[model samples]
Target: MRRILLGAAMAAMLAAGGVAPAFAQGNPFQPLVYVNDSVVTRYELDQRMRFLQILRAPDGDRASAEQALIDDRLRLFAARQMGIAASDAQIDAGLAEFAGRANMDVEEFTRALAQAGVEQQTFRDFIAAGVVWRELVRQRLVPQVQVSDAELDQEMQRVIETPRITHVALSELIIPAPPGQEAQAMRLAESLVQSVRSEADFAAAARQHSATPSAENGGRLPWAPLENLPPSLRPIILSMQNGQISQPLTVEGAVVLFYLRDSRGTLRPGAKEQVLDYVRFRLASTAEANRIAALSDTCADLFVHARNLPPEQIQRQTLSQGQIPTAEAIRLAVLDDNESTIVSQGGSAEILMLCKRQSALLAGNAQEAPVPVTAEGEEGAAPDPDALPDREQMRGQIFSRKVGQAADNYLAELRANAIIRRP
Candidate 1:
C-alpha cells in the first residue's frame, strides 16, 4: 500500500514539480567498483541493484550487471571530458523528476527510497550519468551525426503511408519520461530495462508493482488502437514482441508504461524490418501520443507569444532531446502541450526556448520487415519473429542504426589507439 501510494505521489509530482523540505539523512559510504577516477562503491551499486530489481532483469543477464555500471562510468568519463555535468540544480530537478514518475511527493519519494534501502543520492548518481552522457554525446559525438532533409522527408513519407499495427505487450519494464524529478524516474526506468535484460521476468515485476493501473493485471495494458498511441511509441512497438516493454518517454503529466503484446499486419516483402525502441516519458495512460503532439504544437504557440518578453525573461530552454526537429519531426515528434515548447535537454515543462542547431542523432524513425534467411544451400528462410523489432510500433519506428554504427566505429578507434595490459 505504501509503495502504491508513493507511486501515486510520484506520478503527481511528475505533472507538477514541487517537493518538501529535505530531512537530515545519514551519511553514504558504501563503495563497490572504482571506474578510473570514479568509484562505484557497494552503497552505490546496492542502490543501483535495487533499482534494477524494479526493472526486472533476467537471470542470465544479472551477472553482467557490472558491465552496465562500467558502461555508465565510461559515459560519465566522456561527459566529464566534454565538461558536461548535471548541475546541482539539475540533480535536484532530476530527483524531483524521479519522484514524479513514481507519482509521489518529493518528500514521500525520499522516504520511499529510504524504505527501499536506497539513499536519495542513489537516484542522483544514476540520473546524473545519463544527463552527462547525453550532453557529452551531443557535444562530441553528435557533430559527426547528420540527417538529411531528404531522409526526414522519407521518414515522414513512411509515417504517412504505413498502416502497420497497435499494442505490443513487451516482456520488459517501461522506463519513464523526464519530469523535473526525471533522474529518479530514468534510473527506475533504465534499471527496469537492465533488469528485464538480465532476469527476463518483466511480467513478474509488473505484477508486483508497476504504477500503471495495468499493474493490477500484471502490467498488461490492453492493446492500444494503432491510432491511439503516440507515434513515438507506435513505431517502437512495431519491432518488439508480445511481451517486450518500451523505453521510457514523457508524454503528458505522467509517464506512460508499455509492454509489447502482439502485432497484426501484412508485412511487405523486400521492405526493411521495422525496428522500434518505444521511448516514452514516464506518465499515465490518459497521456496519449496526440497529447504529446498537442504539447509540441502548444510550445510553438508559446513561441509565438514569446515575442513580447525580455531576453532575460525568456526561459533558457533547449530541445528536450538536445535538437530541434525537422519539419518532418515537427509533424511526427511529440512536443510539450502547455507551452508549445520543444522538450528541452534540461527537461520540459517551462515556457520559451531558443531553437539552436539541431542534433542529427537524437530521435528518429526506421522500418524493416522480418526476413527469414538461411544458408545459401537451403531455401530462403521466412522472416522470423525473434529477429524482428516489435511490429506494433509500426510507422513511427526510428532506429538509430547510424548512432550504433558510430558507437561501433568509436570503439574500433579506441581499440586501435589504446595500449592494453593483459596478464
Candidate 2:
C-alpha cells in the first residue's frame, strides 16, 4: 500500500510536468548512489532537486540536492540504529503542519507541489526524516544540555549593560553605473574596496569618482542614526570596524561603498525603543492587586490568580516602549521581569506584571533603526520583524543554538564513519 502511494505520488508529479523531459528519458528507478546498505535512486534525486527549486532555495543546485539527500539518508540510518522511527500519524501531522505554513491543508499542498514537479512522497520523506531526527536528538542530546543560573545571570547582565549604538559617522562613495556601464562601475568599486584602506583613501576615491553631491566633501556625512540609513545597510554599517571600508554594493544605477568613521552608543533615550511583553490583571481593589503581586513570581503565575475571573479582566500585551502610555511606561521601566506594579485604570486597580523587555532593534521593529540607504541615495530593503526574547527565552535560544551546533558535529562524525559511495 505504501509503495503504491509513493509511486502514484511520483507519477502525479511527472504527469503534472514536475520533471524535465531529459530526466524522464532515463530509467527513474536506476540506483545512482549508495549509503551503507541503502540506495538513492535517480528518481529521488530528480524529485529532491525539483522540491528544492519549488522552495526557492538559494543553493538548490544538483550538488546541493545530492548532498541533502545523502544527509537525510544518514539521519534516517542513525534513527533506525537507535530504534527511533516516525509513525504514520506523526508524518501525517507533520505534513499538515508544514502545509499550514502556506495556508493550505495536506491535499492542497500536495497539489501545489505536484504543480511545481515535486512528488508527495518527496515531501513526506523530507518531513519524516526531520521528525525522526528531532525525536532522536531529544532522547539522546537533550539530556546532555545544561544551563546554570550563574550563566543566565551573566547573560542577563551583559544584555542590560550593552550600550545601544544610536549614531554612526560614515563616509560614502557612489560610482555611477549607467545601463551599459554596470560591469565597469562594479569592477571600479571592487578595486576601490581593496585599495581604499583609510579615511583619506576613501575620501580621495570619493572625491575622484563619486557622483553624489557629498563627494565634494570627500563623501563625508555627519553622524546619523542607523535609522536614517536604509534598513539593509544598518547591519552592514554596524558590522564594520572603525576605519573599515564596505564591500562594493550594487544599486540600480550605481555601485556604492562606505567607510565607517565612528559609532556611538547611548543608554538614555534609547531605552524608550525597547519592546515589552507584560500581563495586566484587573483587580477590584489595590489590596487584592498587591496580594496577587506578592503571590506571583512570574507572569504565568498570574493566571492562577485570574482563574476565577473573566478572561477580559486579564490581558497580555506586547508593545514597543514608545507605544506605551507615559505613566505606564514609567512604571514598567523600573520593574524587572515578573515584577509587578499597581496602576489605577478607570477607578479600578490593575496589576501589571512585566514578562520581558527586549531591545527594539533585536525585536526588529525599532523606528529609530530605519531601512538601509546606499550612498547613491537609493532606498534599500527593510529588515524583517523578529521578536526579541526575554531572559528565559534568551537562555532557551542559547541552549538551542548550542544543541544545534553539537548536532551538526555529531552528524559530521556519522558521515565520516559511514560508507557513502556513488554507483
The most accurate candidate by lDDT is 2
The positional error of residue 314 in candidate 1, measured at the CA in angstroms, is 57
- For model 2, residues 43-77, the per-residue Cα lDDT tens digits are 89888888765543434678888889998999999
Work out the TM-score per prediction.
0.40, 0.48
Clashing pairs in 2: 18-117, 227-370, 230-371, 230-372, 230-373, 231-371, 231-372, 232-372
- RMSD of candidate 1 to true structure, Å: 24.3
lDDT over C-alpha atoms for residue 279 of model 1:
18
TM-score of 1: 0.40
Error of 1 at 103 (Å): 1.7
After superposition, candidate 1 runs with Cα above 4 Å error = 1-34, 55-64, 153-161, 166-423
- Model 1: per-residue Cα lDDT over 152-239, one tens digit each: 5455545434545533334333334444645455446555665664223667777664656656566655545665766555566665
